[model samples]
Target: MNNPYNVLCIGVNHVPVRRLSKLDYAEKDAKTVAKYFDTLKDKAHVTLLTGENATRTNVLNWVKQCSNIQGKLTVIIFFAGHGSAEKDENNKKLERCLWINSNLDTGPGSHQLKTSEILNLLNNPLHQLIFLIDACYNFDPKQEVSIQDIFKQFKESERMTGLKQYAIISASAVNQGALEDPQLGHGVLTYYFLQTMAGKYTFFLRRKISFFRFLAVLDKRVRNHRFLTDT
Candidate 1:
């Protein structure tokens, strides 16, 4: 496949000593993504950031630099780490956030990378942009925002042009936990997504896979796993 794109893979396995629990396989997840993309050397430029290096500032800087690229560009960002959803005080809706290295501090002003920040940084003049978030989200019943809804809002926002193609895929649905499998040595969603991308578990569809088709296969594969029932 002639995949012309630039890939940024960020994986966070541990926070600073002050924060919560550690993600045992997040670094592995990032490495796996980088390795997979490495095979597409003919069609892509891949950058991998893991552990302490995957800080908010570094990520933001890279995104800004990529936005300045001259010609047609497709940027794919894959984040594997902790994610949370908090109630938006004004809208009374759940807003998603990604825990970066700096978010480890429990101080009064500590901040994680929220959906809005990401949307702003990535809303550049790129041909296509894709986000794959593999993290557990604290879904609230009162105002849970679906993955589609989040991206839709970005499309409608004044900062972004409606013509740009964008896609955001989450590992799990609202109020669900994105579980990792010891057997597979990876997050269940990531495992399936890679498999589908590599054409491992396709349902005999020999044709080229579309983005939505890949999502459908990934969702089905994840739903069928018996051990991943823990939310």
Candidate 2:
């Protein structure tokens, strides 16, 4: 309970709307990550938000509260649900968005949370925000905007004033889908992440594995995923 990390694990198995397809292991993926942290028993707090509890409002409110905790903190927003893209205002561009629980049938803003919106909410100096999105997007042409381009927009020169740090790690690349299988019972992204953390595989630069080094291992595993889905 005294650790400096504040982790929020969110996974949604189903969206209320009839249009969205039901998922088999999204919720389980969330609990799996949360359980890993729970077993570590070294975090300041591990808040697991699954099913309906991970709605837009609840998630936003919790993030809003993080700004008030005046101290050095690492706030990790680990999501294992769906990630898609929405058309921008000009209708010529698409932005990466994370969809939670929303009953609305309207466009992206109503039922989805854009990466830009998340940056705005967690724009605090005291806490470092880390985003882990395991959603499957960009397999289609309409939503072909890559996560790399989306995050690039936020590197505004103006944000250098007080922003601590914002790091985002996605499960898939530009044109791939975030993958999962019934056999693993967990998304490929989540599984490899756990493996990386557990030191299951050796790295060439194992002497002092940096964050980028860790990401390299995960990126390799996801790219060569052995299941039905490909990330």
Estimate the TM-score of every prediction: 0.78, 0.78
Give the per-residue lDDT digits (tens) of candidate 1, residues 144-221.
567665554433322112234676777754445677778889987678777887784442123375556666777677
Alpha-carbon shift of residue 73 in model 2 (angstroms): 1.1
Candidate 1 contains a number of clashing pairs equal to 0
For this target, which candidate reaches the highest TM-score against the unseen true structure?
Answer: 2
lDDT at residue 114 of model 2 (Cα atoms): 71
Residue pairs clashing, model 1? none
Candidate 1 regions off by >4 Å?
Answer: 1-3, 17-19, 88-93, 103-106, 109-111, 139-164, 200-207, 226-231
Shift of residue 57 alpha carbon in model 1, Å: 0.8
Against the true structure, candidate 1 reaches a TM-score of: 0.78
Clash list (residue pairs), candidate 2: none
